[model samples]
Target chain A: MYPNDGFRELDRQECLRLLAKVPVGRIVHTRQALPAVLPVNFSLEEDGAVVLRTAAASELVRAVDGVVVAFEADEVDAATRSGWSVVVTGPAGVVTDPGEHERLVRTGPRSWVPWPQEVFVRIEPELVTGRALVGGRSLYGVRPPKWIPARR
Target chain B: MYPNDGFRELDRQECLRLLAKVPVGRIVHTRQALPAVLPVNFSLEEDGAVVLRTAAASELVRAVDGVVVAFEADEVDAATRSGWSVVVTGPAGVVTDPGEHERLVRTGPRSWVPWPQEVFVRIEPELVTGRALVGGRSLYGVRPPKWIPARR
Candidate 1:
């Protein structure tokens, strides 16, 4: 871990490795112009892609398939105030190849919800970034950001 | 919990209650038309607004202050494969009220990071939604979503 700032930027490879350590994450996609996030159970492949199973009727499948989205996961210790987060952003598409789809159906990440989640979405990572808060410090820098409310 | 689909929809009140139960969450915001998520430690007020502390120089501070963003938190039982998630969306602004800011600094949610973290960002929630998967069934539906690879 980086020592000075207590915050270290993780490289792409490190990000992927960290992702494999966790089974759950949040997927972020744009609804209109606002960003929406949904929790998902995902697995990382050897090639750095993320595979997730979701409900066919869920909003994520209807709107996010084939769209650019972001997947994020992290492990944090609240008491220690230390944790690392990895985010993968790329196009999320339905698994189309029959052979691969069959394999994923049997081996891909499992879902926790009971709804019929036949939809298998794969996020091909275009960019990966991560950061860790080390030294048990939750805040960074010498001071906190200024929050000034507007008089509207 | 909702009995049939093993999916239960939580109300706004319950969503806020759950937020208080977890000290960490992910904040989702749009940065230059791309969605970015960052893990943060936060606290909830009785009014349902969410408050957090961050460094002045952080990307979250620069990009999310006075912006509308989505904050999500969840806890899943790995063994049981059951969990719940809550998402809050609203406009985040710097606490301009001196009295509130001071109170938050003293009694508000504390940060794990050691930086001064004097900067307090408050997200006044416009929408709060949540869902829970109970009864421990990790896989959903009788049949998963259909996946077919494009023939290119």
Candidate 2:
């Protein structure tokens, strides 16, 4: 039992369950053909769609529309040094239907920033995968080194 | 004052400074032509390299070696609904030099899991970007919905 890797693969149900627990997650998309990470507050839809509202004019809204992107959310406990990370990879679409937009506006994620105009982006979870890091709490924390040389 | 967007852009030095404060970050890479994310505990080297050690046989080690990836870490204070997120984008290279590997062994990240054989992957910070979500603490938390339809 000890030799077994503590990295446990989670099932689809569990992955989505964990996804619903966190309010913030990083959205991974390509900007200028290179990966870019943006931390955004998100809401999980009933159909496993990861929905987030951003400013209408925000660069992310335009860049991610109809594009495949990855969303990740996780929680690591300090005392246990263990947690589960779930990644959802799928295509993102800006919610444009007035009816659907109204539904989301009434029961969607609270805005982290107030913007003049905002739009909803929904990411369909086409591929879901996650791992649980468990049973390693021996190391308390790394001592803060007095200094780290400026990398310039 | 409130007219300004709550998200204030951070400069390079400040971005690295925030990156150094967190031990855990998510590494975004491509798997099967689709983006994937993994939470890793990393250390900052003097040369601004983000280093993380993982099992030698891990798929990520092979998938990310010499490939461009994105690394992000952030801190959120539930108190003020404010925090900073920093992302570093660059190419990842596995430590092949014996001397460098040993050097990392002496002062690298403490493993959250006990892996028998681990390899260190170093990522250069080519493009560093970050933002501060400042001043929005009114809403305490989101209440959980009583039910959600399972997506099948």
Candidate 3:
């Protein structure tokens, strides 16, 4: 991590690592020129693609096919006032190959929502970026405010 | 909540009520024609506007002033496979009036990032929509698969 301002920039590998760790993220796509953000259960694959399952009737399944979209995932600790966030931008391609779809279903993150999530989509990342706020480290190495509790 | 498929739609008042309960959300905006999704700590006002603080040098402060943006917030239960999400769309107007800015600072959500967050942006919602997946309810009213865990 390279510190920039009070946050540090994470390398691509670190960003992908974190992306794989989290099961839920928000996918941002444009609908009729207006941006729409939807939460999704997604998984990162070995080739750096992000995969997600959705219902066939989902608006996302319809709108995001072959479209450039943004995926964002993060974890924040309110008690410690710190967290890491990653964003990936890419083209969202629907998984149409039956064999590939079957493999993805067995490997990718599953939706927590109880719906028929039969459609699979993959995002081939064009850009990956991330930032982290190290719990006890300020930009200039000053002591944190007493009000901020230390992490366990 | 009126059921649509396996999800239920929440009205405006219910949407705002849920928005006020969460302190963090992802704000979506367009940057150079591409959608940018950012994690932000935000709060809701009595009149249904959303407010958040960011550093003056932040890209969000530069890109979102007087622009329409999408804000999404949600909570999910991993154990019960249930969740609810709310999305708000509106113009993100920078709070420039001194009294108004101060009042927002006194009540709006504060950033946990260790930087000087001097810019305040408010999103007065023009459109609000939300959906919730109630626990124990399937779309077809059939018993959920045994793979699905029961609510604790």
Cα RMSD of all models vs. native, in order, equals 6.2, 8.5, 5.7
**Candidate 3, superposed: residue stretches over 4 Å from native:** A1-5, A111-117, A137-140, A143-152, B1-5, B111-117, B138-140, B143-152
Query: Positional deviation of B36 in candidate 2, in angstroms?
Result: 0.8
lDDT of 1 at A41: 73
Predicted structure 1: lDDT: 0.71
Model 1 per-residue lDDT tens digits across residues B1-152: 11133356789988888888998888888876677887777888888888888665555666788888988888876556567888888899878798988898897777554354456788888888887656432354442211111111
User: Compared with the true structure, what per-residue lDDT tens digits does model 1 show for residues A1-152?
Assistant: 11133457789888988998887788888775677887667878888899987655555676678888988888987765567888898899988798998898788976543343466789998888887655421354553222111111
**Interface CA RMSD, all predictions:** 9.2, 12.1, 9.0
How high is the lDDT of residue B97 in model 2?
96
Residue pairs with backbone atoms closer than 3 Å in model 2 (clashes): none
Tens-digit lDDT string for candidate 3 (B31-78): 776778766777888888888876666666667888889999888764
List candidate 1 segments past 4 Å from native: A1-5, A111-117, A136-152, B1-6, B114-117, B137-152
lDDT of 2 by residue, B1-152 (tens): 00123446688888889989877888888877888777778899876789988777777777789999988888875446678888888999989999999988999976655465777899998877777665534332332111111111
Q: What is the interface RMSD of candidate 3, in Å?
A: 9.0
Task: Give the Å shift of residue A11 in candidate 1.
Answer: 2.0
